[model samples]
Target: MRSDLQQILATTDFHSSFDNAVPLMTHLSAVRPNTLIADCGDFFEGTGYYRLGRGVLERDMLLALYDVVAPGNHGWPHYLESELHRITVCANAYGRDGRRLFRPVDVRSIAGRTVAVTGIIGVQAFNAVPYGQRVGQRVTDPALALRELKRAYGQVDAWVVLSHSGFEEDLRLAEACPFLDIVFAGHCHSDAYGPVRIGGVQVLKGYEQGAGFAQARPSESGWEAGAARFADASSLSLPNTLEAVRARITAIARDLREPIDKVRAPYRHTVLDRRLLLEDIATTVYSETSSAVLLNETALRAVQLHGTLTRGDVLAVEPFGNQLVSVNCPERTATSLVSDLSALAGPMVVVPSPLPSPLNAFITTDYLAGALHLPAVPTGRSLAQSVQQALTGGTR
Candidate 1:
């Protein structure tokens, strides 16, 4: 046991899998009282909790926990509202008034050394977010931000940067910013297996969804790092549970528990194999719009169980908030547009609609349609609503 060595427990892209992550964080904190617990951001999204509260739930929980974090692109849509109890640092994310959203750097005095930590979100994140939602904020180049952060904190015993920037970008930043001692990277969502050294900086990243954290011990030259220990939340004695959070999540689940459809088998999700869940989505969407050439495979987020499917179960399978948008276009044009998704490997299961004409009415997401450069309008029916309608026949 390196009890004499100071440790820093870190995580990244923790999308409020707090049920699993919070306990781990608190446990490590208890064991290493002087340990610095932190996150690399993308924490304000995912799960039912995030959907219900629009980050209020996460903000409250994270702030209550007093975990240090950097901002990720997920919260750029609500920059001002996402600020936590602790100072959020990211040298790149700026305000409409040309000011930094959070502090450019946060210096923490823990154990025997002065540790300065900073954060930066990816600029590409701004492009992914809805244009309307990100009016006031701007994500500048992280490289420039790092330079500014270095200038601000001229000298420190240890310099740690909590980067929401992906691993590749972090590598580039690490090589360029020689002043950095340690970089905790996020957004890419890889465990990294072990830490990597770029130039003189020791970089680390933990697993996604708050499953685990990475521990790094200070070394004479730099730092010794390793893979994140992914621990099952159930394994912990007296596993962490929040009644208030549970009750809220439970209430949402209960509401969505109404039976949708009975499936003979589970709608399993596998990257290599096509999912039956897409067939369900395709059929439901067809029932709603009667549009031909519906595409439902690519946007899928979860898998469904066998037994009776409920709204909750269906939601678990398709968690994204994307709505079903029906648009009219030519069959040639629609097929051509979908084929443009060069990144998609598996064959897209296209379900034909009953509607006829040079106009091929189709269904897709606003974001996806924009990417395909397809002129599509929302029929105002959300993907969830369409599924619910398909299951219940609009009786509800």
Candidate 2:
């Protein structure tokens, strides 16, 4: 009987699920006695107080399961190199004292064969968010870094690319580069589980936030031809180590909640004011700054005008913590960007009646009126312009 090929258990976008580490480690120990576990970046960031210090917590938990780790986009932030290094040092200090904390890639011998694992931090050079707001340090060119991985392919039995570039970019990379045998993706928070063949490459995205894991093994057809599968950790009805972590999170949430003690005047809504506010936020606050805001004032106005605004509604509209960033671009570029935003605008559905509360309504009205009449002047562009172009189809 042929021995089972070495199993590779890969997870990504864990954010800060310190509780997930225990169960994941337990599962790894039981299922694949000699498996290699990898964190494909974005293992940090966007987490609440409960998830804070998760990097250190997870590293300690991985002592019994994981052997390797790769950085993701959320793993680093501006002026936070020390924080990243601190996590690595702490992880190293806890387990395998002599081992290195993070590397571009790790080459290992599994089942009597050599396997190469490469990691690349997703680039923010093309991201629409302001430079200072995007957490985690970014690599300049992910493709170029992957090229280095290609050189080691021939020497390894299997090659895996752990990426945090989301599904679309991963698909594009897989099509453009053929050497990658498997790509584990994160950052899009997509629910697509199981192995998908994209341009002859096996791509897997294991949901998000410690929801599950993806497994891959070599079949009789050989490494390149083997099939892969995904398993949902939550559906597994597995023992819940995450519950303890959730409890801790709940306590933190309660501590964060405090009554708004300030007495404020009752607010009233006005159609003209609402329209102006929406226009101002989208055009002056968002457009004037980020070149590409990925939003529509018409949609916001429609929703608010219909009395459908809610706390959750506001969050969904501006989900990303985007900052206003000024970019210099030629008039043509600015015009094209606006055209792209117009084309991208889609329909919206509002749930309440035809009136709602209005807060700080005047700021918006004045900003919108001023912006609408302002002339479009172009100047030399910056990184923000490049990012806008990338978002608006100026770049692939």
Candidate 3:
């Protein structure tokens, strides 16, 4: 008989996988009794479903899983002091007993050995957010947090970091913190699996949106502990119990999609008007809204220079959920921002070229310079600075 120590099942990028998680959880439970189920991160935000107030969809899904949970970025935005209290109160009410429901770290004893699972939301919440928005949240700094995690090295036989940080940061953490044995990561929607040995530490990203779960066992020589298991959630159809739970969630999402009464104008941007539109959208609007105006300005400049933009393009340019905010900056600060935008527009910056439409003539010379490397330099500035300065005038 195989030694029945502890089995670890973890999922990441579960952006409201609440309904979908039921079947996955049920299957996992049936296969491995008393295993640790962890919802890594992005459980709440970034989906059209949540935008329709379907965060409750995720909340209900988590309620059913009966496992250890940790904070993701999506969960953080909705986190209020009151909500935290309510979550604790409700977990107690639900008769699901464990320190797993809403805690940063949980330690479990299995198969005569203790294991520690430490969950960290990605640093994007800080580095990616616009300036003023990152305030007052108790986020663990990845570098400092790793030091703390090191303290627990000898305390537990296995240390797992359940992270919502993107792949790069997670890999960095895994390399930096040799004490960590496994890292289950999310964000960046990377469908990577297996033991990615980064400086001898094995890191794993279990794909996204509850598509699957990653299972690993510790062997005598670290994570090479034989073949790890990656179970695909899509491979299994809904079981009867899960079918019922899923129906409830689908009905809720369906009901929420009904149109609400709100008066809003349709947003329009055309090739002829895109430069002007981008100028307004970036400097006058987005800059005022977020902390990192330079970042926003770079994105807008890319859009304005290239007349064609897509939803994906917009997202790539501004992935962070930065809102429009303005702070008073002295002329020097504003000047520095202009300089930064100029640097971002240099020849090395490979911007997307617009499709040739009949509307190309309407594009300004400045926009053309950055987009097509046109030699039309405005009287007194570098190619990059001239384009950026011209964009501010709305004439572009």
Candidate 4:
């Protein structure tokens, strides 16, 4: 550990769960003087706040807090916005004309020691983004980019990577880029919270959805890193400075909680049983459009709905704002489409227990249609609407 540096704090994959904003911000504000605050991206597009508020809140929060950030596939476009673009650092992303998309490294004097903070988006994660959203954008191999950056910024005391790649991919990255001191990982939502050392590099991530952060402080060996939850900060009150932001968030959340419908029984969705919720929505879409439906579990979140349902509940269930689109599938390609989708998205919900061989057409999200390279006819409806219908047993 360097004598000049104090501590580093970072959040990853915060998918617009602003319910934690006050406490999180209160904590961040308290620690801002000595702590280097950063985020590993996917900050936008998750709950009703992002869906209905349209990223204003997310952008505002970033402007108010983050010092540096990495871009994630979920909020790929948001990183391009001028305010965020200025703070974003990425080593690999490039435009079609071969121009670097963002500053490869952000060098700052953390205390007195020169520290270089660089970011990289995994190739697989970048490709997972909707094609249209990433038009004219391309990425090189993350390790390749890091190697180039290391040579370019050779004078830094410490090299830290804010990676939008999953935790496992980062372990491999750490092995490849042994020059790195610490790797803060994001994008793959799994139970693995590791400061798992790989070839002398430390790799870990914060608990996602604004619940926690990853922290690093100077240790005798090098840097000791671990995950920290925001539970202690839950009781913290917002300062007068952030009260306005808190009010706006409250107003928007209240609107999102406005009742839209009712449910007779509780319908629960959890990580273990995401398929049940997807199956229910698939049935609704199938019944409405009279077409086979394909829905991946990742498109929707796991939530429990009961009694009076609100827009927030619906959006929480299917947070990405996906729209249903119809795509034609010939008999010859139908089987292969199912197989390929199964491979790409594990254990997806396919309407019709056994897909009919002569399936003429099927319904899927616009994102999936683009991913599959299939021409789609827009149904002029959103998956969130279908979720509402499914729960209420009626049309919106």
Candidate 5:
């Protein structure tokens, strides 16, 4: 009976877990012997390590550990490269050179059974593309990607889709293909406790930063899947390479005392009142693109700060890897957006007032824009770029 059960472990939305990266891999490796480990994407660009290291330092560590990987919306282009994604299985992503970045499907032998894994991202990206990374690259329609993967690896004993696409997309995929047995959902950032059944498929989701990975073990009739029970890995020790990266990060922190500008009254960001900050950010975007700025209030997830401003301070306030995008929408929709946002507190948003009947709008993040169903054009100007330009060498 024990021999009949096989374990497949997975993690999604790591966002560059600097702490205990390799040691966590060690822990995972030792925890489940002969288990096939897979990582769903959005695995980079959160902490200072990404900013300083360009994700290479942590990328190498992840390469050594994960058996197969998928590129999330934020971890695109870089993670799509050959070195990191050689064992990857992403159906939708392509390079600017018009080449498929990774193998569409991976088949692994686990517990005398064949386990197949593949990945798909949201139709719209959560993170904007960094400059000079890849020009004119496209993530092909995910629905088509799944059909392609299905035709290729349809006969596998157990199949899993690491879906960075939202929950609804996963449900659609599950309905389209009855062969799919399990789905690990991402992009929504939910810590789903149990499985949501759609046809024969069981979908599970883990929270941000590997709150805990998903664990799926074989059952008598099918697989049993859910979030793993464990402590957050933030306190654990990192591997030697990452420890060295930490050392560099610490050193960099020492020299970060240079003041960029001064702040008036500490320009605090509070949920109770976000008007001042939004208007400030919107004004900047308005100047750059000549578009009314609309931003998801979640962009300012930092605590109150008012004092001498540093480069670090600005980056901390706009911590997400979002870029400014220009969108053309009916001015009335702007009113509708603010109205809808006013009604809901969870997904708060801000749009500059008195929009022209037909006007151009500047947006901050794709995740929010997509959720709001706004049409946008990519500007390639990142949040860091906007902050540096807005608050650098200038008092506010």
Candidate 6:
């Protein structure tokens, strides 16, 4: 390793996967002495950990480990918390009063070079956040935001973006803002972990959830970037300073492992087939409720299941804790509602796949209903409960 080389360690779309927090922190701890640690966003609100701990665990990890972060749509408000807000940077997002929600930039020294770190949430990604959560918040275009930020803060050695705008958008952003040196991506959850060069910019994403991270090291041309998994860093030991954190995480893990149900056959969750599981869940809900059902694929994370499912496993599958609700939609707008939702949420599975024309109402999760601003009546059900029911074939 060159003594003058700068290194950056980054993670994105963590989505509160506390199950892997300890080891991930251990890896970060080992590299903390020299590396600049940051996250691209969506680090909170995914599993039972977030629901049970109410963001305390995730907040603790960020305070202890990350140097800087971006605000993601999943846990948009958490970024506004006083402590987190200090380290959070989002050049494009604004609050209801038309004031900027966070400071536009954070200037940091990495390997003695002045680097300007900024963040932006893509318009589509911001729209994907539940309507109620973002009632008064809004985000501008990423390219436009970057252009303005560069104009004002062009004195830095390099400009880096912690983007929750998905990868493809970042590629275009790199092209639009050629002055940016690097972009770390989040929110899409796709398999593209590119250190792909666009013009003079490098765009990349870490493995999502708690699987791994991406890093950039100074190179002769510019910077060399790539992804790495926690397993690869497991040999490095964490200093005793983090022992208490590990203990707390261990206790939480024990509680999360409590058995919830049993499955007769294994249902594997993969990138290509996660929506199939959602379709199964939607079908089960449709059968029980005798109503049409709609589900956004992003509402569930990819996790496999077999015999002896645990509470943590179920929560990991439907981490948001969204309630299963029925909402009334006018016949005239029902079709457009699904189409608009699909646009923001990527692919969606609507039970009775054709989505009958003149559809009046349907059963959907609270997140989706809130996204469309529909009045939702609680069915006294949750996506977690429905997932367990679907896997176990029980009504509960």
Q: Where is the poorest 10-residue window by lDDT in model 3?
A: 87-96
Q: Which pairs of residues have clashing backbones in candidate 5?
A: 20-238, 266-306
lDDT of 6 by residue, 1-396 (tens): 224326888899988887677668878887777888889999998888887788887887898888889989888778889999988999999888998999999887776778888999999888877788788888999999889988998789888899999999999999999998999999889999999999999999999988899998766777789998887554566666566666777777888899866764546332324677788888878887888898888888776665677788878777787898998886545568778878867778889877767778899888878877778899998888878777767776
lDDT top scorer:
4
Candidates in descending TM-score order: 4, 6, 1, 5, 3, 2
Model 1 lDDT per residue over 1-396, tens place: 123336677776666454455465446535555566677878865554566556666665555444467877666544456357235777887669998777777776644567787887877555555454666778888878888777878877878888877887788888888888788888876546347787788777877777766666666756777656565444444314434654555566566667766543333223212245456667666665566545546455444354565665555444557775766556545445556532332346566633244445567666556544567787776766654443334432
Error of 2 at 104 (Å): 2.4
TM-scores for all candidates: the values are 0.77, 0.53, 0.57, 0.93, 0.72, 0.90
- Candidate 5, which segments miss by more than 4 Å at Cα? 1-6, 17-26, 94-99, 126-136, 139-144, 191-193, 229-276, 283-313, 320-352, 357-396
Error of 4 at 294 (Å): 1.5
Off by over 4 Å in 6: 1-5, 231-241, 266-277, 353-355
**Cα distance off (Å), candidate 6, residue 274:** 4.4
Model 2 regions more than 4 Å off: 1-5, 17-33, 50-66, 78-102, 122-130, 133-144, 152-154, 198-200, 223-396
Alpha-carbon lDDT of model 3: 0.48
- For candidate 4, the per-residue lDDT at 106 reads 81
lDDT, candidate 2, residue 237?
Answer: 36
State the weakest 10-residue window (summed lDDT) of model 1. 265-274
Model 3: how far is 109 from its true place, Å? Answer: 2.1
Q: What is the overall TM-score of model 6 with all chains considered together?
A: 0.90
lDDT at position 122, candidate 4: 96
Question: How well does candidate 1 score on lDDT at residue 64?
Answer: 48
Local distance difference test, each candidate? 0.62, 0.45, 0.48, 0.84, 0.64, 0.83
Candidate 4 per-residue C-alpha lDDT over 78-192 given as tens digits, one digit per residue, 9 for 90 to 100: 8988999999999999998999999888886664557799999998889888988888889999999999988988988888899999999999999999999899999999898
Q: Candidate 4, overall lDDT?
A: 0.84
